[model samples]
Target: MLEEVKNYKLKHKNLKLIPITTKNYWEIGWLELKKEQEEFVGDNFKSMAYAYATVMEGKYAKAFGIYDGDESIGFLLIGHNSYSFEGCPKTLMHSYDLWRIMIDKDYQNIGYGKDAVKLAIDYILTFPDGEEDIITTSYVEGNECAKHIYESFGFKPNGDNYEDEITLVLKVK
Candidate 1:
């Protein structure tokens, strides 16, 4: 899986999902969404904390900074077999979840979000943590931008909800 992701990085050149690290944590921490957009995606810091908690519980979770070359433009977090998480819907127990994603306000609507989605799908396809038959994600009810992006990649809502957010899934196997 690592090899596949490496090959993908070489081909893409500009856009990549670099895992969070001690050296680059500060830069990623400063990445932010627009004020109104925060309501939909929540805050990156909170997402990171959740990822950390998920991992500490002996499950799979990974967080990355979405970068274009050397610039940090967004954040992404993914988890596998995460249905055991306290609030997760039982329907997603066996899936890989694109748990969270956010592009900085400065980088929105200029294809960065679209490219990041592609990079994320490529990464998930590698099955970095473990194998899963499908990938899942969700967006808040009114977040049309997220709805369009996920749907563009063939993610269909599966008639499930986690709080106010609607669940969408893409079958990969």
Candidate 2:
């Protein structure tokens, strides 16, 4: 857990991962989906437009907003090709692709991104009595910072690539 996420209680100063709903979709889609962020993740990845159309409209993915207290600072999407167009790692039963996770430039560092990733993994762990499961994600080549962060959570490069991005996986037990 990140030091910033003090607790889960409603009144506490904690990071939250909320499902994106119709009421807040448009606002969130445009808030953190900036040009630089898009280019950084490579061509195959999409931020706002792709995420909303696929996850919100097409059911290709599921999305959550990263909030600090009451403010939205980032976004996350989980899915795979089997579920829709965006495919994650191949799994025997079920798994999460961790398709997209980003913290707005303004909110970079200060543990928001780290805790958000941890929260995402925590969400995955709750699957079916918290049995061990696979969660896969990819990062654009040269983004060692991301590799480090995800690795800190036990994600490891398995010699796979999503498009040109290096693929990594975590097995939650």
Candidate 3:
């Protein structure tokens, strides 16, 4: 395991990923991204709805409000032992999935998105659901910014794609 992640901290120290709850979901719902970037990631409400549905179906999925101090600045969703669809690699089963992450328009380009990713990686290293070797995520093919941020942390495309999205994986075993 990448034990060092337990000590990970963002250069912007106030940034954090707080679990989304009824008390704060409303604030997370209000976060907005640039119009052109909307196609890259789903809105918080939709992502949360999917999280709910997946949990209802006996899967593990959780949403988090990405906060800078007390302000809700973004959203993140993570899954474990998921993606049972056709064409999914057998290797990805029983692994962690960085399902969705997004930063509000006002917070973009100030390094929060990158920092939030680091926090997400830190959380995954804690193995919230269970221990696993791989963490996976996908982005719409043209979302170069997402690709860059994920790649910066060693995620690599694994020759898999679903529709317009391409899958990337980081081996943490």
> What tens-digit string does per-residue lDDT give for candidate 3 at 107-147?
88988988988888888888988899888988998999999
The CA lDDT of each predicted structure is 0.83, 0.65, 0.86
Task: Tell me the lDDT of candidate 1.
Answer: 0.83
Q: TM-score each candidate.
A: 0.89, 0.73, 0.91
lDDT: worst 10-residue window of model 3: 1-10
Model 2 C-alpha lDDT versus the unseen true structure: 0.65
What's the C-alpha lDDT at position 169 in model 1?
84
Top model number, lDDT: 3
lDDT of 1 at 104: 92
Clashes of 1: 0
What residue runs in model 3 are displaced by over 4 Å at the alpha carbon? 1-9, 89-91
Best by TM-score: 3
Candidate 3 has what TM-score?
0.91
> Which tens-of-lDDT digit does each residue in 84-172 have in candidate 2?
33553344125566777887767876677788887777676555223435777878877766787788777778875556678887765
Query: How do these models rank on lDDT, best leading?
Result: 3, 1, 2
